[model samples]
Target: MSFTEPMGRQRADDYRSAMVSSDPLMDVAAGLDAEVAQYFLVSARCGCFMQAARSLNVRPTQLRKHLALLEEQLQRTLFRFQGSALTLSRDGQLFHAQLIAMAHERKLPVIEQPLIRLAVAQSILHDILGRDLVALLRRNASVRLEIISLDSDLSLQAVSADVVVWLASTESPLPGPSFAVSEPERLAPLEYLPHIAKRYSRVTARPVSLDDLADFLLVQWQHERPVESFRPWHDIVDQRLAGVVQLHSYELMLEMIRCSACIGLLPGYMGRFDRGLIALPGLFDQSMQRQVWMAVKRESAGCEQTRMIVDLIRNTFHERREWFDT
Candidate 1:
């Protein structure tokens, strides 16, 4: 259409006619929406109507309208609500994952600056002070931090992590080449609690000490250590208890603790860097401290920004060490 042309009724009618029946635009739009709703639902982690709505970043009212329209088109309820809780019907789950897989390559977040690949032990991923360092570097747009967690320093699998955070002994005969970043604290044992599922509430807890714990359970990240000699917390086996109950994930260990199923070691103070988990009087001694390292690959040897972040970790922990917590 020419700019000189008036958008009169006749022109509007012509455009509408062109855009419909004989035109393919509506079909294209409809197709695009099919992909959009699914992507929004997956990224949002919303299984039902509300979940899809929340993930789409649209208001519930607007999402409801879209969902109603979608359900009307499909002629089925995607979810069933019972007692204020929303549950996905079969179709909702099928469509949910599809959205995520479709959007994976199309929408990975990107930043323009050179990124600092930071490999950290998953356990210390509690409240990283990295964002401050990241923002500081962003001034010159120098470095963006890529955070990955590995259980062991041996598996520095991150092809890109110029720097890493590791927990080690002040006494280990390990390489002193890596610089220290944060001081470590002794990991003390928490009482084992029951961790049965709600339906299966019949569970029990047994007390075991460092000597009698050889038969107890220990949580270790298999990716970082093998089953027999797993070292989730600085080779807890070296201290050698009687028997250990083994677990793999830190998150899982937390879940186990929540369920009151197993006893595990927890960091005493200034952990979580936010709330801080504190040890009780006889539970674990807080006077003891451990050393954390911010080691760099020989390749990034002289990078000032890398050194700066290590300093940030050290200073953050040192300055806030008083958070002696619960």
Candidate 2:
């Protein structure tokens, strides 16, 4: 049987992490007693067997036989007919819920591709830009890209990404030389209190330190640029903040910043692109800037596909060097 959804649970060790796990739909269908489950589907939808049989294009006798088979498997009667109306027993409601959930489980979507084995976040494949990048990467090439969904930073570092884009600074990955875009390490501290959202427009003519960022409400990415936990500032964020709201994307954060939701730490390129995000002087120093980097195992980095991807991403972001270097 062909089913579309990736199986098990996101990042689970069981059937999900396994490169291929039979066919997810087939696996799920194999678990249930088909005759009974189908009966439950029709019975739960239509009250009477005769009406359901007509609606489903099956004979009432046939439908009843399916139900009988299911009842035998579960050793429980789903419904009992009283003089005229069909009534669902307590067992029936519970079984009905399971059947619906099973139906939903059957709907997981997974598309098949040939050879490329990629270990990355699901969001990468789903993001607007990410989608474009993927389409570009998969064009008639010598290799196939296997797309895998990674759930956390540990998974990212533990496994391997031919080219990595992350916010955190760490010892260069296996093959050494790495470059960071909009380097997080170089933010120039503002000498004067930075003009944050309009609400903070009058924050203080006096300067506020970066360490004081916690004082203002901050709207941040629910998924931050993956940073290694060892970085001091990674955890420097105010632990006691009353105004941290996590959002789904950077675009939304910029929107919130425009509304003065709070002061935001935005990328130089992204900040300049969004008119709403104007950087004030105090949050970052003149020398402060975040860096984007690309690193890969020596052998993997030599692959033409991976090299092209690295060059495309690096050159694309490299054009924005003035934002950070300036």
Quickly count the clashes in candidate 1: 27
What is candidate 2's local distance difference test score?
0.50
Model 2: residues with Cα > 4 Å off, grouped in runs: 1-152, 170-216, 220-241, 246-255, 284-290
State which candidate has the highest TM-score.
Answer: 2
| Tens-digit per-residue lDDT, 1-326, candidate 1 | 12223557765565455444523333333354854465335423443454454434345577667666655665655556666666544444333333334457468453354456677656665534555555444443225567777565455442346676655544442332344433333322112111222321222423223333344454433443432212324355456554444566777765554454344555444223323122222322222333455666666656766776666666766665554333
| lDDT of all predictions | 0.47, 0.50
Off by over 4 Å in 1: 1-112, 127-143, 157-160, 172-245, 270-290, 297-308, 323-326
- What is the overall TM-score of model 1 with all chains considered together? 0.40
Cα lDDT tens digits for candidate 2, 158-244: 655455543333333322223322222221211112335544455463236766665667665555544433122334343544667
TM-score of every candidate relative to the true structure:
0.40, 0.41
Candidate that would win on lDDT: 2
